[model samples]
Target: MPPPSPSPSGRLQWADVPPPLRARLETTLGAPVTEAVTPSGGFGHQLAAALRLAGGRRVFVKAAPDDEPLTAANLHEAAALDALPPYAPAPDLLGVHRTAGWTAVVIAHLDGPDPDLSPASGDVEQTWALLDSLTAAPAPASYVAAVSAAPSAAGLLHGWKELRDDPPDDLAPAARSHLPRLAELEAAWPALATGDRVVHGDLRADNMVRDHDRGVTFVDWAHATTGPACVDAASLAPQLVLTGHAPADVARLLLDHPATAGSPDTTTAFLAALTGHWHRNARRPAPPGAPGLRDYQHRAAAAGLALLNHRLS
Candidate 1:
């Protein structure tokens, strides 16, 4: 099945990259560029595209100006890609370069469509299988040191309290009514954090692409961090709701998944906090370059609230 809804991917294209930066990329690869194609999904990065070299190698590159906010995330992704153990399922980092005032990350281009996230799709099993393995693998010492001071999933996932401080007028009726309870549950969010496992701090369909013969390849490690394995699985639950699954089904799926089953802390509280994050951000005006992001967040917020309400029931 295809995605339930496709979000607008308004981002910097290859044609828009400065000539100086473009020349630097080709020079770094030691090959003349053949073609560059923008991806069909995602809206976070400043510039994202797959560059094919004359020598027949294709690499995916994402870049932003050094002063741009996304440049930091591009750097963090390079670190995560390098820091992860070889056993991890992420793409290989091809190169990291800072040239012409732009920070760019290049990785081996993934070769298929994003896995179908519908309720009955087998991709869900493969998705969790990867996460189960990821959670079980010991985080590398280098990775630990690299992100030593960076925020974990726990710290970044909190938003309910913020919404509580200044509730937005457009919240879903259920979310608006349960604001106090959601905030109370979200306060317990920190309890779920742990540094024992690697987490794709933001896990969702748009961040993945798949090949049936080889399984799925996860992309966009910008939000990658160390946290309890359950948090990674928890991140995908809201997205499932955006697909075809009912809120109750999504809840049961997480409550039963190996990566999350044992961790009750992964359910109600995490979902509430995630919902608040989307709802709060969705209310804000769209950022300068990334359009459709707020709408994606808004849809995710509603889906998250539905699942949260089901769990609360």
Candidate 2:
């Protein structure tokens, strides 16, 4: 099946924007918006559009209501993009706007297609190169201190234990049978993700944009954080499978990465934790204002579990 699709619930059109916010955007670009287009790759669950100005400038804008949870995420994204290293390939932040109804971030437009993670695709290598660049420097001090201070993956990877305590009838036979062991294995995850490198906490094909000239530029820094360098590389393993690579191919990719080598147990634990986290979250009701998120979580859980089973075998 194709990847989960983007939702329209929280999306905003140019006409939906308040006049004051539109005026602010015009002022930032120093011209009037001539065209606005909605891109179709991310699960932003809020306002996201690409705008072209009369003066020929282009920009990407993302916004959310001030009272919504995504508002804080928008702010974090702005800070993260502003603080990224010179070598990191990401869009430049142009400005931010906060009015009574909306909080928005304006960034330079990146014209490109999403990377192809299909088996043996050159785009796979491009993604790897982007990850290499991202981890080359430590995360920004302020960004790390603000975002990493929250609970680590260890605290959030215990879905198996929770499910075991009150079993879900729909749990897959493999997962149901392995629940106890999965819980035990996942307990080691926190230590595995501890390191001084910055992680794109949510790395996936949709979050990557590949330009012929710029190579690969990673977008959506809302989930960026400071963690073990290996975590970012490891996180992409299951996605490789989801996008057409076999489990062995994914394993080989990991083995070849220096940062991921000599950490078989850690990799396994991290994958298991990821499976648990997605499995648990997939069964819950979609959060308010995010209509398609739960379905995406379910698909991601299946992919993660498939990779986890492969590693276990």
Candidate 3:
């Protein structure tokens, strides 16, 4: 999917780099960058690009300003990439660079475009394969468990309760009518999220790249967490809908998967919780430096609500 519109805190071009940080990066690479191309997808980084050195070597770099609020997220991604299991489909971490005013990760450049998740795309199956490989491995011991992370499902999935306490004027009529039951259903997330497998936590289209030889390589690990393996597969349901899959078809596809079998109730509840979560956030004021986030959340909320409605009916 084409990334949501650029945000004020969106990516910085190659020329925007400060002199000191640029020098440090070149030193670490052992050569001066001959070319820098800003990557098209992703919203989290202030600086994201593919850098080519004089001798034909290339690396992917993602960075954030030290004073920017997302510096912690960048650092966490570096740690998560370093901690991934050997079999996981992800870029190799070359190095991490931290200075007084910047934090960046250098990764082996993968040669492929982001997967096209739209309906009828063959890339869907490739993405499924990627998720299979990812969840088959146990979470790295060095990384924090999903429940302990900042965006833990246990923490963010309580949107129905929050909405019940302070309903937004723009809340959908269908959602508003089901508030009480939704709140009750959302309360089960903590139990549902408990599992031995590690979840990508944030498994959207923009976070995936399709390599001809490697199948798919997942990127942006700031939200990596240990939780129900099914959560990652389940998380893709709404994304499928967003990309033109019928909600009912998406539900059936997920239900047939081994990862999601025998847990229809939990899956429905999780979808409902996600619906409320995105809806609530979509109505709030945009965070500093993230002007396009609310719109993206709104679109995501609508997709989740559509799937939830299909499951509920």
Candidate 2 CA-lDDT value: 0.77
- After superposition, candidate 1 runs with Cα above 4 Å error: 1-9, 165-169
lDDT of each: 0.79, 0.77, 0.76
Tens digits of per-residue lDDT, candidate 2, 1-313, equal 2322334544566666667888987886799999988877666667788899997888999877787778888888788788777777788988999874888899888888888889778988878877776776677776577565445545677688888788898888878888888887787787677777777778888887886678778888887778777777888888887888887777777777755675677777887888888889999877654667788778778777777776676
Candidate number that wins on lDDT, 1 or 2: 1
The 10-residue segment with the lowest total lDDT in model 1: 1-10
Colliding pairs, model 3 = 146-226
Q: Rank the candidates by lDDT, best first.
A: 1, 2, 3
TM-score of each: 0.90, 0.89, 0.88
Per-residue alpha-carbon lDDT of candidate 1 for residues 1-313, written as tens digits (9 for 90 to 100) = 2211212466676766667778888999989789988787777647788899998988899987788778888888888888888777788888888877777898888888888999889998888789888888668888776665566556566677777788767666797788789988887777766657887887889798895456787888888877776877888888888988887877888878877888776566777778877887888888755767899998998898888887777
User: Which runs of model 2 end up more than 4 angstroms from their true locations?
Assistant: 1-10, 140-154, 288-291
| Candidate 1: Cα lDDT at 92 | 86
Q: How many angstroms is residue 204 displaced in model 2 relative to the true structure, after the best TM-score fit?
A: 1.2
Look at candidate 2 and give me any clashing residue pairs: none
Q: How much RMSD separates candidate 1 from the native structure?
A: 5.1
Clashes of each: 0, 0, 1
Q: Give the lDDT of residue 313 in candidate 3.
A: 69
Q: Output the TM-score of candidate 1.
A: 0.90
